[model samples]
Structures are given as C-alpha cells and as structure tokens.
Target: MRDRAEITIVGAGPAGLTCAIGLALAGKKVVVREWHGDVGHRFHDDLQGLENWTDPVDVLDELAAIGIAARFDHHGVSEGVVFDGQAKPHRVRGKRPLFYLLRRGNAIGSLDRALLDQAVKAGVEVRFNDRVTETAGDMILAAGPRRADIIAAGRVFDTDMEDGAWLAIGSELAPKGYAYLLTHNGRGTVASCMFSGFRDQASHVAATLAFFERHAGLRMQNPRPFGGFGNIRLPRTAMQGECPVVGEHAGFQDALAGFGLRYAVRSGRLAAESLINSTSYTDAWRRALQPGLRTGVVNRFLFNAAGQSGLDWLIERLARNEAGDTLAQAYRPSLPKRVLFPLAHHRFRAPLIDPSCNHENCDCVWCEHGDHSAAIAGA
Candidate 1:
C-alpha cells in the first residue's frame, strides 16, 4: 500500500479521508491507513452538532464550495434553549439554521461512515487495522487529539421525548464548558463537556442529567456511557518536517467550544490543494483559518474570566438578538480581541504534554505510552 499510494494518509478520520478523496479524484493514487477497525470507532452513534452560526455561509454550502458533498443525514436546528446557571431558560433563535445535528463515529449514519464511503468511492485504498509505524515519501498526519484539555462524558439512549436541543451553562454544572442534551427520532444523547476538573466529571454529568430531566422532561430508556477528550490550541506551526499535520494533530480546534469538524474538513482540503499545487500548506491554513482560531482562544479567555454572572448576562443578550449574528461576531476577530490575544495565549496555552497517553486503543501517534523514540508512525 505504501508503494502504491502517491499520497499516504495516516488516519482514516474526516481529515485523512477528505484528503484522500481530493487527491484520488485528481488522479493521484491515495491510500489511507486506519489503526481502528473502522472509521469513527471512538464514537458510538453519538449525536454531535456541525455548527453553522460561526461562519456566514451555511456549513453544507461551505463544504460544497470546497468540493465535499453532504451525502450524510442531517437535521437542521433553527432554534434551541439555553439554560444559565440559575436554571433560567433563554430561547435562542437563529436567522437560519444554527447547526446541523448528525451522528458521529462508525455507525451507519455517522459523518465518519459517510466520509469513509465517499473516500472508497473516490478510489482511495483504505487499510483498516493497519498501524503504520513507518512509511516512505509524502504523508499527512491526521491523527486526532492526543491529550485531554477538555473532557466530555455522557450517555446515549432510547428516549420517549420529542426532538430538541437543550444546553446548560454554568461553572457548577460543567466547569468552564457546558452540558448538552440532543434528541432526535426517539434517540437521545446527554453529555457534560467540561473544561476542567476531569476527575469530577461524573458528578457534573449527573448534575446536568438531573437539570435536563427536571426542566426538559427527559427520559432515557437504555443508556450507554461514552466519553472522550479534546485538545484546543493555536500551534506555532502546522508542519511535521515535510509531512503536513491536519485536523487535531495540528492543534486545529476551536477554543470557545470544542467544535473541530469544520476546521478538520477545511484543513484536509487545503492540504490536498497545497500538495497538488506544490504550494505551502502552512500558508494556506494560516490565511484561511488562523483568524477564527485565534478568536476562539480569546473568546475562551473571556468566558473563563466572566464566570457565572457573565454567562447569565450573555444568555439575556442572546435572547434579544438573532443568535447567528451574535455568534458570528463572537467568532470573528475584532480589535479588542486582537489586543487581548497575547494575554489569552498566555493563559490557555496547550503545549499538550501528555505522558499518560495509552496508545493501546488506536495508532494515533508513534507514542509507546511514555516513549516517543520511534516517532515513526501516526494517523
């Protein structure tokens, strides 16, 4: 497979698959190696949002512009409820759809599954359970987060409740992040996304479940727990020697929230285009994505400083205006944020020093748990 592929991608996640599809369609032989048995193996039919409010263009339209079609199932959500610290509900209405709800992981209708099929159809040679330790020639590292800056722990289950999106934001509920419940077609997902206090995630998840159960009339039939972590930071570079690191491998994640799908997909396309054009992937991503990602870091800093009072006030303000407009501004780089960028960078610096990474599960990195001598393979 190594000798066959003109481009060897180390991960079969969205970034790697997207890169493979683009390259193969351009008549370049592309092969993707996934240590996992299948794509989206980390998630288990978990419901996650493909947020659209941050960018002016709708996510699907934006993906189309980049040549990635929306072949997967999606549920558009135009409005939702946000509950502040004191159990106060704020109705949030977007001018268009706020975000699209889709399943993640290796499931039948998941984004990962869709991308895998698209890559295969595009003539990408995908090798599953292949832990590529070493390879020759061009490679793109798309292995996801290797460290846990933020952790989300929760459950998915069958429910009798109607379709809806509900979120709870408070320091006591979910530390610096938020707790959310997304339900559609009798399936429900409840999760607590916490920015800190990883050890206390259980209590926070329980608190979020209780809050939603009381306020939203939530009901779970057969619940199954699922947990994962995220790493968000503005890296100094996007290159690992000649190999371009896309997705979470490049530390391309949102600071304010844990949304990385858009970044992942966009970076993948940029990497492919750069390789095809024999240009610089670093310049491409910097021009296209750095501003928003920097804004996300600043936004996270502000959120950290605001605490409960600030969060409550934010809810009140979002209640008055269209959520899409306000959220877009929040994500965009402003003068004030530009001025505060240095301080924000100083505060939430994610050097991502993870010594406890047990690579027993997936071949994300060549990390032999505590060792890194054979930094030879990654996906």
Candidate 2:
C-alpha cells in the first residue's frame, strides 16, 4: 500500500465504502483497509432492514440520491403484526412500506457486495484482511460501533413460514428493546434485542422463539446463531484524533428504533461532502442529522420509561389513520416542537428507577440524564 492517499478509510463497511466511492469519483485517491476478507463478513447471513419510517422518500430513491443503485434482493414490507407482552397481536398496515428486508452478507445480490462492486468500479482500492488501529493525515474512521447499549442475539434458519416480518414488544422477550423476526425466500432470522437484563439473554431468546411459534406461526429447521450490538449514545464530537469518524463509530444510529442504515449512508455522504468542500465534518453532520437524532434520543427516553403498557399503546395508536397522519407530521422539519414534545411530556413511569445496566455493561448516561447532554450541546 502507498504511504499516503487523498483519503484513507479504516473500515470497508457501508459508511466507509460510500465515503471512499464518493471521494474516488471526485478524483481523489482513496483507499479502504478492512480487517475482514471481504465485505459483510461480520454480518454473516443475518437479515437486516433499511428502515423507511424516518424519511418520506422511498428507501430506493434515497439510496439513488446518494448514487447507490438498489440492485440487491430486497423485499419491501409495509405490513406486520405487532405483539405486546400479553401476546395479543395487532395488525399494522401502512400505505408505504415500513422497511425493506435485505440479506446481510457477501452473497451475489447482498447490499454490501453490491456496494463493494460499485466502489471498485469507481476506482477505490480496498485492502482485505488489513486491520488498522490508528492513522494519520486526512482519514475517515468508519469501523462500525465501538460500544453497545443493546446486544442482539440472532439466528439464521430455514423456515416454512411465509415471507413477512413480525415485531414483539415486551420485557419478557426483549427487555427494554424489542424482538423481531423476518423471513424471505425460505431463510429467516429470529432475534431478541435487549437493552437491560442481559444475564438472561438465552432465556429471552428462548422466550422470543416460543412467542413467535405461538402467535406468528414460525416453523424452523436448521438454525445458526449470530449476534451483534448497537451503540445508542449522543456523540460528543465527530473527530476521533483528527480522523473524522463516520457511521456507527460516531454514534450515528437511531436512538429509538436502532435503525442505522439511513444514518450511516447520510453520514458518509456528509463526510465526503465536507472533505471535498473543505468544511468541518462535525458541522456538516450536525446540520444534516442533528435535531432528528436528538429527538430520537428523547423519544427513546420516553419509550423506555413507558415499559410494556406503553408499547401496547404505541402499537394500538399506530393502527389508526390519525396516528399515521401524526407520524407523518412528526417527520416534517418545521414541526420540530410539535413532533417529539408530547412524548417527552407524557406521564410515564419507569418500571425500575435505577438499573444496574445489565451488570454494568452499559453506561446508560442518555437514559439516566435524559436530554441534558443534548441541551448542553445545544441540540
């Protein structure tokens, strides 16, 4: 490898690849160092989502806007059944898709493999099995999540169930987080995402499987377990030792729903634009994703406070047309005050006042302090 380039990225994940491709297309020399042999190696074959709830534009259009052609095998899903702790399933059908389910791997049509092909065609050089710990000069850190507030235990299996998605909201299955199952083309993933009470993760996953078997009719055969974690804290700065951190490394994740694809792509684009224009990456991301991210933080605080009953209420409200309209209004930038203000002011009580953070695994600063950090940063 050359000693220097116009830009060097540490990780070849979605964010790093996007930034490297953009920079290379702009006539800049860009090189990416990935610890894995190929793209999406860490994700295995787990099913992930490109969420569409936060933005009004279709996910395909959004990816196209950033110069990504969505040629991968993805299934658009707008309808799903939400089950509460009581095991009562509520049907949620929206006019537009809530999310698109896509496979995460280096398979023929996987998102990561597609992006890698585009990057190579754009003249971006990628060094496989090259793990970079520190760097100098103009660099972008996109090494994925550093710390996790929630751990998701997932399994890929062959199932006879029809292609669809289902979400379970309750402490019994997922603790403060949520459990989800998505199946497409005979492949399925069952995962339990938990924010607290992690000591019983196995029990939780077992319970989640049982719940799905009972309510969603999940039939499984061969199973392979894979897991991942999420970082959900407000970022203090975009720079990690002069290198601009992109993607989950900068905490560019959804605080409420753990959807980071949009944020990852958006942050990568912003970082590339900042470097090209000689602007600050920190300022650019703040301008692009700030207020919305802050609102998500507040929404998460309230959601965690609401517990199982609150989840039930949210599912019930989501079924109504008026609530759908309200959600659309919340997405508008002009209605910032009207959108998340009610969630913060709602009279909800936490089931546990002080949590050990699952045996001191999570810091829970955002949860304990609420929006104080955002206030200090003027978010």
Candidate 3:
C-alpha cells in the first residue's frame, strides 16, 4: 500500500471497487485494501448461487461510466410469479428486467477484473489480504456487516433467504424473492433465492422443493440445496466527520427490499463526485438517494402498520406483477411534494418525540424541573 494517497478505500466489494474505479478515472491517486487475499474466491465454488440477479439498466449505465459492464450469456425474465398460499399464482411483468440469476463467481470475477484493470491503467494502487486496523483522513468504509466494530466505536448511535430448484415449481415455493436452478455450461444446477425475513426459512425451502417435485412430476433421489442472505439498511445519519460514507456503510440499503446493487453503484459515483469537486458530502448523498429514501420510509410505515402478511399482499400485487414498473413509476424523479412530505413527516418524528417519556430527568429542556428553587439556583 502507498504510504500516503489521495484516497484509501476499504473493502473491495461492489461499492468500494466502483468508488476506486471512479476516483482513479478522475485522475486521483487511489489505494484499495481487501482483507481477502484473492478477489472473487469466496464465490468461486458457488457459481450459480444467486436467484433473480436482474441488472437494472441504470446500474449498467453507471458501470459503463466507470468502464465496467456486466457480461451475461443468458437473457433475464421480465415477469416474476408469486405464490401467496391462496388462489391462483400472480405474475408480474414490466419493462425492467425483474431479476437475473447468474453464477456469483462470474459477476464477481467480471467486476474484480474490470475494477483492477481500470485502476492499474489509471495508476491506482491496490492492496489485497491487508485488513484495515485503523482509519483516518478521507477513508471510506464499505465493509458491510463487518463494520459492526467501527460502528460500536462511534458515539452517535441511531441504530438501526433460500429457495430451490425446479424452474416453475421451485419459483412458487419461495416467497417474495425469486428462485433459480441454473446449470453452468451444462455442469450442475445451483438453486437459491432471497428469503425476505420469512419466519421459517427452512419451511420455505421445503415448500419450494415440494413444489418442484409436484409441478415437474420428477424427483432426483436427493436434490442439492444451497442458500444465502442479502440485506438493506435503513437511512442513517452521517458518521463523526466530513468524509462521506457510501454503499451499505452509509445505510443506503432498502430495508423493505434487499435490492442494493443499483443503490451501491449510484452512491459510489456520488461519493467520487463529492470528493473530486469538493462538494458537501451530506448534500450530495441526500441528492443521490432521496427517491429510494422516500420509498424506504413508506415501506417501513406500511410494514409497521400491516406486518409481513400485509407486505406480502402489497408486494405480490404491486411489485411482482408489472415486473417492477409500478415501483419504477412510483420512484420517478419528480415525486409530488404532497406524497413526499408525509414520508418526511415519518422520518423526522423520532427526533421530535420527547425522550423524557422513556426516562425521568431527560436532558431535554421540555422536561419539567423537579424543584423550582433548585432550577433557579442552577440557572
């Protein structure tokens, strides 16, 4: 690693790698460090692990801006089917690609090679197998759950899937997310899905297998099962300083939906721009993700009001069928002030609540002073 660089990014995931590529493209000296020695190693063994790996066109555009684009041999389905345990299954179709499933290794390998190649071409230094023990200056932390320690060390603390295998039947078995069984170059099939916090993940897995067996009317003695988890974080305040945090580190994930790759790419570009142009990081972040944040607030409200069943109903009805066109329309850049004001109301209420209600002698001035004479004396 260079002793001193204009920027040092930790974690070589999509977010960090994208940022590094963007910054280097802008002619800034950059160094990136990853704890893992080899890029895309963890995913090498599980090539066909992801289900519904849809590539949003906007994400592709952003990647292209940084000189990296996803290469997939298969076309993605725009329609997704949802089984709600009642009535006929629902199908959602839209203009956007619903979700695309690919081998994790392929996605990671393409991105890793693209990022490193661009960084080297642009004269950016990269360090692998080097864990960041300490951070200072303009450092970006995109370590995801691994950053739990860094979060704990800070003072301001506003805290905070599986499926299987038959093509049609297995898809029905999984809830909310997509299920896929893909054979890589005619080798073997890898089946998986996104769980969406279902109460019984194992049961969902079993149900998917059963659906495959019943629908396909065929069964191997023992079908292989593989599963994994994806996540999105709530909107959170900026950390201790002026340096901007991007991607999962800054809580840009949609808590309602686990789709974060688009957001990650957008946020990474926004951060790079902020650094290069010397713009206010907070302003840039807000401008970058305002729509998603608004949507997230609405999602949280609905989830709290109706719970999973309600969410399932809405998602099945709205999100799945029109593909994600309804969502795309809802998330348009020109969101009505009337619609957004309510979401702002929801997001701002926590700071407005009186802490004294939860604990006596709260520091808030609204709390009544117990003794008038003592209060006057102290004043």
Candidate 4:
C-alpha cells in the first residue's frame, strides 16, 4: 500500500516542527499532525525558569534555517551566583557578560510559524488539532513522553518537581542539578526543581521555600500558582528499527541538566535530512550527535555521584574564576585527542571498577576461578 504522505511527523514540539520545515525545504511531501488545538499553546504563559543557557549561536543558526531568526533576543548577564547546601555562596562572572535566555513560547511560536509557512509553500500538508493514533509510512515520532507507546516499552525515570527560580533556597534538597527561580516579564516568580528525584521532591520544595525565606526574606505564603512539568530523556536504543525518532521522542533531553532546546532542534533537522535523502537512521543519529551524546553520558554519571554534595562541589568549582573556564572547556567535545583521552579515562574508568574483589565466596567467576587458576599455575 502506498503511504498517504512521503513523511508523516507526529508532534509539534521543536523537533517535529524543525523536521517538518527541513523536509519541506528539501521538497519532500511532509505532513505534520499536531494534537493541540493551536500551535505553541503548550507553553503559552509562565515560562519563568533559569535562563543560564549555552550555545546561543547554534540556536540562532537553527532558527535561521527554519526562517524564524528574528524572534531571538539575547540577555546579557555579568555573573551567576552558586549556592551549595552548606557552603558560602560563590559568585562567578563572565568576561563577555553575555548568555542566552528566551521565552520558550517565543521560540516555539517562531518555529511553528516558519514550519507551517514553508510546508505550505512546498505543497506539504499540515494538520492541527488532529491526533495521530498510529503511524504508517516513514513515521517520525517527536511526541515527547507519548512516543513511548509507539516504540518498544522502556522504563521511565520520574523526578516530579517543579522547575523555576523559587528553588534556590535549600536547592540541596533536590538531587544533583541546580534549581531555578525565574520571572517572565515581571508577572510572577516560577520555582523549579531541575533534576531532583521524586523521593526527595517534597523536601526539595520545602527547602527551596526555606532558602527563599532566609535569603530574600520574603514570606509570600501563597502556594505557587504554577505546577511542575518534567522533560524526559529517552534511551538512544529506542530508535532501533526502520523509522527514525526525533526531538524529545528519541530522548534527546539531557537527563542531568534538563536543557534540550538546541538538541531537539538539531536532532530534528538531522532526522529530516536523513528521511529526505534515504540515509540510515543510525548514521543520521551519530552524525547529528557525534560529540554531544558522549559527553552527556559522562556528565550524567557525575551528576548521579555522591548524592547532591558532589553536585555542590561541581557547581562551586565552576563558580571559581579559573575552575569555571576549565570546567566549561572540559564540557566541550572538540578538545584534542591528547586532552580528551585522559579526561575520558578519569571520568569513566573509576566507575568501571568492581568493589567485590576482596569478598570470598562471591559469585564473580573472574575473581574466583580465573584468579585461582592463575595462582595454581604459578605453583
């Protein structure tokens, strides 16, 4: 049976929209089906969260590629304060005094408009308020959490905490990552827990409130008006078969950091290019995320280490003038092989060691049989 469209994309997030636009630009017949009544409505209001973003240039390039380059506005910040659970706060400023912050809605709106326009111009069809119950031909799933149903079932690691600025107080109450307190256009503050676990979620919230009380000394006793929503990280293995998955559907979100805007856009473009050119999905995945995904694994391992204390150490280290640049440089994957190999060894090797070497009667065959055989041969 012939497919209805050459490509069918489900979802209208950054990934889906970008894919639609890219494919349309390639002159492929594409149909973007969005379940929502209106585009960009999911995050229409209350986008207050931490805006300490990296990769502004890449984001701009993606926007330009999709024809929405004008919507971006860069916010300059002189310094960012780091607060560990018990340590004194450390302040770190950048030499350039510039970083990127944007309203999520604005970015989504721009992409949505540009994608819809391009799709129409290229004679592609777009269906809004239409839910795709199933996918047939060259399906691209970018539906975030819902994509789980379309693919093989995978475990979901949930950390149910809000993401916003009010989380500064007792930010230690969460897991490893930072808490954010942000206000959009002076409407109201949004308190958030970026990467705390569900088990510690309530404690994180209380500690956040306490932190605000102690530092800001403001007792706004009203409950937070906004609820929390989490972005999930899908396993890379989820895209194992014929069709390709893009955006959050493929689990491109950084599990440790919860920053996925750029990743989603980039991955979407890659997926679109692969589909249009008849390239392999796995090759597209690797080419699109050759370096970022590897580093993300290392960082996620660090975030899961030593409770939240280790995270505090990392944050404090970054707040120091010298250490911040070093840490930031370390995160970059473009480092020379001489520098990269040692860092990779340091980050990944120690975790690979087994602690049960000394335990007798343990089930580890290598320690028991292999070691004993070698010792007996020496006799």
Candidate No. with top lDDT: 1
Candidate 4 ranges beyond 4 A from true positions: 1-6, 40-44, 48-58, 72-78, 95-99, 105-124, 146-172, 194-203, 216-224, 228-241, 306-310, 322-327, 334-379
State TM-scores per candidate.
Answer: 0.91, 0.86, 0.66, 0.68
Q: Candidate 2 residues 1-379, lDDT tens each?
A: 2235568888888899989888887778888988779998767688999977767688789888878888788888878877766888877777777788888889888889988999999899899988775567888888776655666776899988888888988778877789999998999999998876655677888888898888888888899977777666567678876678888878788767788888888888888887887878888888788777777665676687676677678778876644335455544445654466556534212322225453344433223222221211101
lDDT of 1 by residue, 229-343 (tens): 7767777668877888888877788988899888999899999998888888889999999999999989888888887888899988997899999898889888999999999
lDDT string for model 4 (1-379, tens) is: 1334578888777678777878777767788887766555544333422222344344455467665444333444445455666635666665543234444442443444545555567666778788766556677887654211111000111112322223232435444445544432333333434343433344555565566556543234333333333344435443635567776567665544555667777778877777766676667677557466556555656555546576566666666655425445645666453344446435543432234334355422232222122110000
Model 3 poorest 10 in a row by lDDT? 149-158
Q: Who is ahead in TM-score, 1 or 2?
A: 1
Candidate lDDT scores, in order, read 0.81, 0.75, 0.49, 0.51
Worst 10 residues of 2 by lDDT: 370-379
lDDT of 1: 0.81
In candidate 2, how many Å is residue 63 off? 1.3
Give the number of the best model, judged by TM-score: 1
Q: Rank the candidates by TM-score, best first.
A: 1, 2, 4, 3
Which pairs of residues have clashing backbones in candidate 2? none
TM-score of model 2 (CA atoms): 0.86
Lowest summed lDDT window (length 10), candidate 4: 147-156
lDDT of 2: 0.75
Candidate 3 lDDT by residue in tens digits, 1-379 = 2234579887676677778878888778888877777554333333332213232454455467666656433334455444443423555575754454344332434444555565667676778878775667777766543211000000001110122222332224443344433332333342324322233345545555455445433334333333333334444443435456666666565543445566676777777777888776567777667666666556544444564466467656664446465666544444463475476445533422222233253321112211212110000
Query: If ranked by lDDT, best first, what sequence of candidates would result?
Result: 1, 2, 4, 3
